[model samples]
Target chain A: MGKSIESILKKYDNCSRDSLISLLQEIQENEGFLSEEAIVKTGKKLKIPTSKIYGVATFYNQFRFEPTGKYHVMVCRGTACHVLGSLTVLQELEKVLKIKAGQTTRDGLFSIEVVACMGACGLAPVININGSFYANVTAESIKEIIESYRKKEE
Target chain B: MSIQIEVNGKKLEAFEGETILTALKRNGIRVPTLCHMNDFIPSGACRLCVVEIVGNPRLVSSCSFPVSDGMKILTNSPRVIESRKTIIELLLSNHPDDCLYCIRNNNCELQSLAKEYHVIERRIHGNKNSFKLDHSSTSIVRDPEKCILCGRCVRVCEETIGVSAIEYINRGSKTLIGTTMQKGLNTSSCVNCGQCIMVCPTGALTEKNQTHMVQDALQQKDKTLVVQYAPSISVSIAEEFGMAPGTDINGLLNAALRKMGFKYVFDTTFGADLTIMEEASELIQRITEGKTLPMFTSCCPAWVKYIEEFAPDFIDNLSTCKSPQQMTGAVIKSYFAEQSNLKPEDIISVSIMPCTAKKFEMQRETMGRNGVKDVDIAITTRELIELIHLHGIDMKTIQPEITDSPMGVRSSAGKIFGATGGVMEAALRTAYKKITGEELVDFKINAVRGFEGRKEAKIKINDDLEVGVAVISGLGNVRALLDEIRNGKNDVHFIEVMTCPGGCVAGGGQRIGVDRSFIEARTKSLYDIDDRETIKVSHKNPEIIELYDNYFGHPLSHKSHELLHTCYMERDVLL
Candidate 1:
């Protein structure tokens, strides 16, 4: 947010507004997600409106507004997962976290998001935490799986 | 180059690269279009303007398809008509069946298209999307269920006004136009310009109705309801009653307001006069002191907010003079209060503006005194028409009367404030006199007129001094102008920026379809008033001169500063 990001902003100073997406990607790569300050500074450097930048950013699922929590939870909502009753598993996680999908927990220890597909249909009704995929997840097993992530955060 | 094209068995002449829709329209051939805005590039999103080509297997969108030599197009063939009917039926599949209670019932584009297509019954029924109504923004109210996703609002907000406050989120069936991160519009860099409302085909976006609040105040016995209307409102409000465009109904409006139970109906045009005085003084002070060059006019709330949010570095360059509406409201709450021995809270000040941003402007923290807001409510000209009809008062039957006394009198300069270059024209009229003890040669400054995105003029005040002024109505134009100024390409000392294109005369709250002709008519009406009045300068207004001589003492005086001036602060665009 200080001198560290100013140099990154300067790199894109010569870039045109069409380069907004790549610039946002570079910033998001450096930072976990697009912070409020990063977006504003990128807008200034690129000479693009922040609203326009946000619009372009929101178009891609890769760009997240909030930083991922200590442990990121992804529930598969693809056809395979849905057939295997992943909706109940996702619901259980939402109920326990007291936050819906696309929201971070109040403590910032965990975040939940619904992914369209993880591309592993064989391992149906899956939940992934911190890049580790957990297969055959059930409504009841969701508690222990989330507990493991919370324990890791601790 | 002219190109020959056949439309429905008739040969038509069209420009070489012209769109099929444009060609058909020029020849008086009708094509039903919802997403197609007159000034904007073709979106081809509506799929309602599909035309059958001679060789093409599928129907092509006439709006996006170009005219080629020897191209045969059937505008209303049975197949094309069938496709359009299906498009209309699909659009109505998810649209709410509440047109009777909708704000844009009769004026709704989709409803009219439905009427034309004879979509009496819903042929294709689907899942109705349940979206939370966004009343978070002070000015605009967004109802997602009513939105047809035509992308007209998105295009106008992004491409025209340079305020891309709302965008298309998600994809395919799940898509809906929303602010970044799906947050409420209040959190976004929405200047509350209401330009989106102007472009929206449905009642999806509308000005937050304050007419009920105004109506409630009118009923209250103890509360003194004082109403003021912007100069633009008088010229455009006539459109609601089927009158000719650019009609001056100020006198009739004053009489109607009195009939509707307004104890005092003062013209905000007088406030525009006061604005010219303070704004001219501010401009003179800036040039003389060389502090903030290219001082932007702060009369437009949306433009003021644009500076505050996007261009905070140039916030100091904004004129400190309160807008005419706010100035009039401040005067009503202060001088009017003192003269009438009425408490500030006891009096309710409402203004009928040709702007939706005025609704948001009334609620600004800086626009208040002693915890009492200057303007209680700001309703658009459309709302005023509704209130007039609700009260069962006809303007034609009423006697033409002048605006109420002490705050009523305004000059021709103030009248032009509704038009695009009117502010700069009025400011120069007075700024010329203030700089060198001489009036401008002629009141009409031709250089700073018309619908060009940006108008610039260099006025040689005398041998030593010259005032370089520029006026732009659209924020998109202002962005380019600002960049030019930053690059040292433009040495303009003063700039007047209005958020909505064509200034307040074609403001977001003016009417539904804001095409070029209506704007010209409205701008001409303002100039006509400016030309008709004997007092062409703000400083020459006898009431304003008396106001200074008695109460304020002078422009930029301590008393004047307290009520007629304000400041700006930086704002966050996103969370």
Candidate 2:
């Protein structure tokens, strides 16, 4: 509702085929993820086929095809976080939300995303949900954190 | 200017800026390649074309390596052969071992390569891929597990057809070709031209098998099964029987259909003649009224769908006449049913076409009347061959038989609809006579006849009406013309667009592994018939005249409009 895909596309010059990635990025930034409609709309704007746009988007791991839930959970899978048992925490988070990494919950209240590093090695097994960090998180501790978000959404 | 290059110790002249593969090909040397499509930029993804260069320490892919002056290369060096063998072995490592059950078992390029390279054992075993087959499209099927990821289908879809309905989805080993959003092809921008199936090196792409439904229909005692083969099938089907390419077996086909229990065997050329009558009249009406100046021929279903999806603005410019296949189906359901005193539901109308798009076309919601489809099933030329083989009919021993009366007689102009630029030539023949009120001095308009993608000509219908015409084959050649029309370029009066390059003679559903000479031969067979036939124009066809006398009063009559023409609407796709 913030801006129609057509309105967002009107900002870009149509001639440049090189702007496809940046245009998709901008749309994903606005809409939280690249919707099928957004990809098709962007393809029409750039005179490129949607299959090609999706191909380019899928080549990069950064792009997501699904929208983020209201509470976006980021589980750091950095070198420090991995050594500190963040994998267990991530597994627990996925179990609690009943969704895999990079997937939103069925109710759209919670989503889980795997990140490389949060640049906070001291916080080792870091779990951030909606910008609120739960540092030194354990597998048991992640469940309570997810419960708190679901309760807060209610 | 030419450059000298040494191959296998023999010096040869090569064109400047030509690839090593091109030079070698000119010198009658063959190097194996997987991803090298003709007239397309080589991707060099498959290293099977690797050759040993004298100066370079590493083997280079001959398909991408540019030929230079005094370049020496050994195409079949022991090391080069070993490298190619290893590449094939590695490809087969993860490939499914169900070649016996595959549709393209004997004709498969990968299997042929494996045999050629002596890949006798599972040299490098890897986890087999288990991707699901995509059977969403009515015309085409996608089996990703059998795909070698050659990218020929992707390139042909994007480059040749101008509809990038499929593309590379992911990166590296995980990369696979898929439609937008990994959804099925039905939701994608595929026009169902089946050009992808033509370029696919393996059994990954094939026409949807409708032969089973045909077999089922043949068994029904109460149903009257009528089969119509397109104009191109007569010339193209001979190749499937090990006969010479472009061998006209139209009479033999009628005999075979009858042998297979088909009650009536009608020629689609008669429908082509009917299309010309209606389409020529529509063009004349549009020209006289000065509306829809350049009437686009809607004979190609893939081209019609492409306009409906990608270029909807030109929908108004498209002639309202249905293609010969549908026109034949409609007439068979209505007029033929009435004549035979058979109910429309009791008649099962099947079509044998040199196209995959006809399968999708017959299923269109608008192609039927009161929920009874005009055409019950559409099969490709390949499927017809299968049916012939399945019935164990001896083609060589079969005697020639004549087609049924009334709807089977066709002019040579109608027969030429199989070739590119044929619709334009046929339409111009009738349009000239309609506009000038005189038979054309020479029925053949050579200007529009060719294998070229685009052909343009200006003809003097009369002093005041010198109409411009353009004949285009592939959809790739249409963008510039469409842009011209959008920019108010009004020189052209009629445009004929066939989705497949070189028209239905080289259609997507024709025999695979065929070369350009076969297409040329098939095209020449049609022209050869036209050269000797007395009835050169569609209007001169006795059956078409009799049809107007009996059923519809004339071309563009209300009854004709109801059955012989249809409307197009804008279609939204994932693109």
Candidate 3:
């Protein structure tokens, strides 16, 4: 284990209902995803019902219940990206990866997620493979993008 | 202080901090709302209660809007009605169109509202939710496709029961009132108290339909079907038959069950007397040995489950006696089986209770650990009504008959087990006799009998031994009392807990949409039955006395312990 949840939780001594959002955010940052164990630990420390903590956590798009794959692909659905048919791009990526939105490939190589307002709206029809952005992407170029990653890994 | 407000062109006196809906209803004006439930904080998620306020340009929800001095409000103006109609139409566009086959059917609030607004044509045919029904819970079912995102069930589960087993998983339109990780309710820490089903305005939540199983059982020729109904059913079942709320119909029910092909239609009250016999002895043993100081009554399955889930430390403190329903089942299988010349497996024991948790309770491994199942099936008061109607048995014209011998006769103390604090009252009546070798001068213990959340009494068991006792109804009220004892701030000797607010009288499986007055009426009928009875205490019941002399030998004997008492397990709350 990288670090026990107890060690991470000790950084912030404020275990109140008011600290729920921030506590969840910090735990997610440390663990890369909000695990069930983390959620339960946070619930106990904050003295809040886990259901209520879930209510607060699920309201925001920032939280992820599952960890990301080794190679993450984020499809931008910003206003400009939507105007440029980024939804088709997401569908093409999902079809090729054999996974839906917010899912990782079974082999643990690739994952796909849809994000709103990805900040690079100028680069419409965007699919950021890992940290590298592939902008103005077409459905024809989708296989080439994954093949490039697979070849690099080899 | 009263604030004057104009509602529907009429002047109304609004209490200072009351909502606009309250003020309007006080003035005989009605506004439709689905998410709002009495005794819970108003959830303004449903836009049906939107009303036109003169100063504000937008339509505001009357349920959460506070009444101010000289506020002009119109509940059913053209614009407001149009807004409400649009909201219902939008909700209809997404809701499943299976109202005919829906469990709620004509009783559905959404259906009634749609009829009121004439939402015949779809304005917005949006993508409908296709959430699979959660049939994992033994007592309750969750159908997210029919859910209107009201959050009443979520609130009641969290606020009243103190078990937040379900919650909002996703946000906005994609939101689902479900367990964490979208797991089945069985995996979650749901105690199977069907209060969620009671508050749900739609058919999205309901009891797991055991009616079909019951019908099949009735049709089966091989099994000897032994049926028993809880004490509360006498006062409760009449309401389902379109009779008055508090009419005691035990005699009629006994006759009807027999006519419906039940071989033995027994009263569960006899088991309640057996519970008192064992529970009182256990309390005396614990008091003498000073092991588990304050014994929590285990008569309410939901309360027992609550302790098992949240407060596992106090599991030993809980009285090991099975609930009267399960106790009756055990006796039927073990004791009654040998007497009736039938094997335990041949007898199909069915319990009719005013609790949804009883369904889950019967299925516990502990209940069936003694080789024979205590109860084969447990159905709510609602299911009993369904069976009665299904058989077309006219309850009114039916000739009243007495219950069978041996497992039939019960004292009034046992009869009162339906209401809150009834178990404590019955136990106190017997415990007093056990402590001091004399029958109580006054049989009635009024201190532990009521609709209040918590009640306390100090019994004088002679000058040297004064015992403190408390009775709690709701699980929310239990935390404070338990905390007191845990912190060593309270010296209470015995505690009584009935999970649903007013015990099994207002149990999760009782009739939905019950008012406070109806609960009081049912509770009064129980007390009246106790007063009218020749024998008021559990120990004094002749059948129970004969049972001890014949079968178990004495109270808390090895056989009584094997048949009556049970153990609790610590459950994972987060799972």
- Please, what are the lDDT tens digits per residue for candidate 1 over residues A59-96? 66667777777788999999999999999999999999
Model 3: per-residue Cα lDDT over B329-370, one tens digit each:
988997788898998999888999888889999999989644
Candidate 2: docking tier: high
Residue pairs clashing in model 3 are: none
Off by over 4 Å in 2: A1-7, A77-100, A121-127, A132-154
Candidate 2 TM-score over all chains jointly: 0.95
The sequence of per-residue lDDT tens digits that candidate 3 reaches over residues A60-146 is 877777788888898888899999989888889889989977777888888787788779878888878778998898887878988
Better of 1 and 3 by TM-score: 3
Worst 10 residues of 3 chain B by lDDT: B364-373
lDDT of 1 by residue, B59-163 (tens): 999999999999999888999888899988999998888999999989999999899988899789978988889888999999988999999988988888887
Would you estimate the TM-scores of all the predictions? 0.92, 0.95, 0.97
Q: Candidate 2 local accuracy as lDDT?
A: 0.91
Compared with the true structure, what per-residue lDDT tens digits does model 2 show for residues B164-198? 99999978777788999989999999999998998
**What is the DockQ ranking, best to worst?**
2, 3, 1
Model 3, which residues run further than 4 Å from truth?
A150-154
Alpha-carbon DockQ of candidate 2: 0.85
